[model samples]
Target: MHGKRVLLIVSGGIAAYKSLELIRLLTQAGCGVRCVLTEGGAQFVTPLSLQALSGEPVHTTLWSLTDESEMGHIALSRSADLVVVCPASADILARMAQGLASDIATTLLLATDTPVLVAPAMNVRMWQHAATRANMATLRDRGIHVVGPDDGIMACNEFGPGRLAEPPVILATIASLLAREPVPQDLAGRHALVTAGPTHEPIDPVRYIANRSSGRQGYAIAAALSARGAGVTLVSGPVSLPAPPGVALVPVETASDMLAACEAALPADIAVLAAAVGDWRVTHPGTAKLKKRPGQPAAPLSLTVNPDILASLSAPGPRRPALVIGFAAETEDLLANAADKRRRKGCDWIVANDVSLPGDGSPGVMGGDRNQVHLVTADGTEAWPSLDKREVADRLAARIAAHLAPHSLIRNSP
Candidate 1:
């Protein structure tokens, strides 16, 4: 990131405090940073603080005579290699999507030719609103980059995804965006099949069994592979996450549907089984919603084993992928269980992680955006430090690219 210039747009949101740390990180990385604070943003952080860290004056208004005389809005917009909106409020994002230039921030965003990255932060309801989703999709389609609004408890005493991405995540994303050359297209001509989210097994028309998997990791992996030039087929269960750009998405509800989708996507170069598939489903599901009788005990439901997707994919066959990877979300004996699973399922590698919660009441891996995983392969187990799921996905995708490179020629041969 050295010598790179970033125009940091701080928007109004509780997460605006994080922009201070973001500026510090950028400056320390030898990148020049200039901040533009919106009216809402000014409520959370002072311009002096940003100016002191950036060693440059802050741009707060569109009509500042002295500032505009020196550097006009047009010049400011084109000055940076990248423009980043940290704590991008729902309002600002909506304005950007609609090409509304009601404020200096929006005007500059419209004027800039530089690539844009936005990190959204808002209430869970607002984040999940149909309008917000549509706006974000529009931005993504337009080639803008988005980092995250990670899931967790918020200042409003609510729990769910809407928090700003941690500072480190923002920093890493900035570095990647500002790189001189395009990201390596190492997976070109390779087909990647990935399954994500928690499969729901129906017990009745209105009831089902499911797990806590949020599908963030799997979605990130799909995005990473696609970014590296792979044709990705994502067989995803019901997850709130949006479909990654440039990937084919097959949405399924039950384990059976997920398995069928994976099979249909086969002859793939690589297969990543990341879904938390249900082990058992109702043997005889009710045709309609089950009813309760006042004097009757709860009706006993018979269960049957669901199809083993990972094992099936790893089965010896000509249609088998060159590399098969599975994820083990264990709460105890993480390494041992993962190793056993790898061997038992006949997969090439297993990414294992302890999803147990600490005594301090922190979130667990089942639904969070961060993970600490152990890569168990034939040679040995490699422990990776805690990282954002996106970073982990990038690292795993790189590894997959390297592993599949040797077989690319054979696969592509006429």
Candidate 2:
């Protein structure tokens, strides 16, 4: 952990002040701290202050005479082992997602090939907006790690999200990133099947019913599996996300489409049903828009149940993977519901998550970033501590990959 190089990107947000304390923590941990402050970020913190705390000259300008003596922006950006964005404001996130680099901070972020860890800070309302939510999902799909915008009182005094995580948590998180030991290529010849996004049920030709699933978690799992040298088949619902590298992606709109795609890509080593498949779909979608009439209001639409993908695949079927896993999103009696779902679905494992109020902005869960889930199986259930979605994916993927090991998993197979 010592001597690990970290470049901290401090953007303009009320949480900029926390970067100072984070620098102290990182330096004390024997890690080198180099900082770059955005123009808007300079409002709350200065280059001189960050430089003093970091014990190195802060790169505050995109075009600096002394720093760019030999190689210019690209070299400067790729020099670090990792780039950490603390107090990553809403504007900075948007800029990063849009590939806009008009300033020093955004320039380095765009130019670097190194992985980035972002700790977001903004108003709860802005954080909850659909656009911001989409941007975050985009970043995570690209393997960008996110720390937190933990729940608490913000600088504006509102009690909600948009709070940057504390310095200690940020430091530990950076250390964790550096400690990544991706699973080996033991699964090189193996195949993985993943499902993601919300299944849209057609109500009419123009409109459809869907959930708030951003497809972040499923995409993350696909990426993680690919990194471990497995052939990945990603069956995604209607989502605006780029497919991960080395993945065979089949984009589908509705649950029926997704099921068909999954069935076609069968006989895999593992199957993870992460998509939030709709339980019901419109019985008969109107061919054209039904205009509102005075006497007879819009007729109540009939509904029909959809196929259960997890159970269908796991019921000793022709395409049943070696390990079939399901996800249970419950508001109450989490373990019980997940356990029941696991037994009924005939899946080997069930990842149970409590999607009550939005989580404290960790990543990969749903709606919000952080996720507290239960890993349930016929043997028993174990509660996973609340962690960012990235950590959860990495850990869970490793477990799935290890299940292919003959000795450790053969006798324990459910």
Candidate 3:
């Protein structure tokens, strides 16, 4: 990252504090950072603090005569190799998506020709809102790089997936973006099939059984694979997440529907079964909503096993992917269970995580963003540190790239 110039746009949010650390990390790596603090951001972090850390003037207004005379907004926008919007609040993201130049930050964003990266932070509900999802999709479609709004407890005293990614993760992403060599397009011409979120098993027209999977991890993986130049098909369950950029999205509800979608996307070079598919569905689903009469006993519900999509994909068949991966979200004996699952499912690798512990005081892994996973393969287990879901996805994608390299394949059979 040496000599790389970064235009850091700090937006209003509690996460603005993290921008300080990001600046420190960038400077330490021999990169220059200049900050543009939004009005909302000033309410959280002061200009003095940012200037003290960056050792440069913090641009705060659009019409500073002296500053503009020296370094105009247009010049400032084009000065950096990349522009990063950290703590990208809902307002700023929406503005960016709409190409709104209401303020200096948005103006700079609009004027810049350099690549842009965003790290979002907002309340869980806001992050999950349809409007926000749509805005994110628009930005991604325009080729903007999104880092993270990791899942965790927010300042609002609620827990979910809207926290800003940790500083280290953001720093790493910046380094990768500023690298001299272009990002490896190793997966070019390869097809990848990925399943994400939780499959819904409908008992009736109104009621359904589903897990807590938010599909963030799976979506991140799909995005990462696409970044590596893969032709990716995302077989998603009913999740509110925006479709990842450069990927085909197949939305499904029931486990059967997901399986069918996956099969339809076959002949893929790699298959990642990340969806928390329901183990059972109603034996005979009711056509109408089930109603209860006063003083009547509750109707008994029977269940039947759903198809094992992972096992089916891993089976020895001509259409089977060259590399098959399964995810094991275990509450106890994580590594052991994951190893067992890998063998049972006949997958080449198992990404295992203990979902029993609460993340940022949240309930479990079904919806949280940070993940601590163990990579289980035939050789042994490699434990990975807890990281934002996007970071995990990026690392996993790199591993997949290395494994698929021609020289690395001599030791194994597809």
Candidate 4:
């Protein structure tokens, strides 16, 4: 961690006390630590303690007259390799999500383009609140990293999530980020076109056909690849997700629209078709609202097959993606179908998932915070246990990055 500077922001909560130890751990790992104490955080732990651990002056206020002489807040935050907030309370999280910069920590966050990680600490009730969950979702969409608020006993004697990650974990995460080797993408200069989410097929002007896919898994993969420093173009269907920080986004409503968009935004290094696209569309979609029939029956709506996005991407065309990945969402006999999809779609890999079981308590693939997945190669299948979807995305994107990496990149990976 030498030469790496960590800007540790301590937010108010019981967990703020841990920031001292976290600072010590970072110092011991050879990182230069700059401490920032939120007004509320200072209530639990003094600047003297944090200053002693970091061996640096503690920054407290956005408008500190002393530090303002040098534009300390901006300079301090921008110079750091990464920014971390321990005991990120629900209030702090909400403020960050809303881009509030009334204080030093949030101001530093908004001012710097560096990556941010937050380890939240709050009461079990506050942690479980719907408002908190929504805020977390929004933060994630904005490319923020979050660690534990691990589940356990809290200060109030209630048992649930919202505990701060211990110092060792934060230290390790910092080490990982510092030691992370840059991905020398063969697709580095080329464009990576990806499609994600369920396309809506209109049943009427008021309603439409769609799928239950949250698009979480696909969007996570997109974010991971974008972080690898690729020029990515995500032609997405309607989904409640933020376009990752550097990637361009094109939204489409139908399968044909997605196809047209992909073709128009083409000539790529690789393409991942993770969308759960509807197989068919209404032949004559009602432009006007279709009223419920009293005596006359509802019009019989014939359907027609939509364009096959995977097959088109794989076809030998001027705009064909060098590598194509297709997703197979199946209920039963997952492998057999995925194998067939690879053969039929002519794509390179099939990320097969089973969505039949939600809340089945099976976890991951079946409905859990984690996932269980099977990767179908031309040769065989590799199974991975249930983990957070983010982990899965990281691993898969690493694999795809490896495959698409150039000859020189393979030599450099080791």
- lDDT tens digits, residues 1-414, model 3? 888899999999999999999999999999999999999999999999999988999999999988778658889999999999998999999999989998889998998889999999999999888889778766764557888878788899999899999999999999988884666998777888999999999989999999988888889899888988888999999987778867899999999999999988877889988899999999998999999999999989999999999999999978888889999999898898999999999999999988898643232366674688899999999999887677788889989989988732221111
**Model 1 misplaced stretches (Cα beyond 4 Å):** 12-33, 42-79, 85-181, 359-364, 410-414
Q: Which digits, one per residue and each the tens of the lDDT, describe model 2 over residues 1-414?
A: 698899999999878999999999888989998888888889999999999999998777867887777646677688778899988999989989999989888887898999899999998899889889878867876778887778798767788777888889998889988887745765666788999989999898888988878777788888887777778999999887888888888999888898899888877778899999999899999999767788987779899999889988898955578888899988788888888888888899999888874444543336565677889988898888877666678878888877777733221111
> For candidate 1, lDDT tens digit of each residue in 1-414?
999999999999899999999999999999999999999999999999999999999999999998678657889999999999998999999999999888789999999999999999999999988788768756764557888889999999898889999989999999988874776998888889999999999989899999988787888899988999988999999987778988899999999999899988878888999899999999999999889999999989999999999999999999898999999989999999999999999999999988895622133358764688999999999998877677788899999998877664324310
In order of appearance, the predictions have TM-scores of: 0.75, 0.86, 0.75, 0.87
Candidate 4 weakest ten by summed lDDT: 405-414
What TM-score would candidate 2 get against the native? 0.86
TM-score comparison, 2 vs 3, better candidate = 2
Model 4 C-alpha lDDT versus the unseen true structure: 0.81
Candidate 3 residue 374 Cα shift, in angstroms, is: 0.8
Give candidate 3 regions above 4 Å deviation: 10-37, 40-79, 84-101, 110-181, 361-364, 407-414
Pitting candidate 1 against candidate 4, the one with the higher lDDT is 1
lDDT of each: 0.89, 0.83, 0.88, 0.81
Deviation of model 1 at 98, angstroms: 12
What is the full ranking by lDDT, best candidate first?
1, 3, 2, 4
Candidate 4, superposed: residue stretches over 4 Å from native: 223-229, 292-303, 316-319, 356-372, 385-391, 406-414
Clashing pairs in 4: 364-370, 364-371
For candidate 2, list the clashing residue pairs, or say none.
12-41, 362-369, 362-370, 363-369
Report RMSD (Å) for each prediction in the order shown. Answer: 6.3, 3.9, 6.1, 4.0
Which segments of model 2 are wrong by more than 4 Å? 14-18, 53-55, 65-70, 122-134, 150-160, 356-366, 407-414
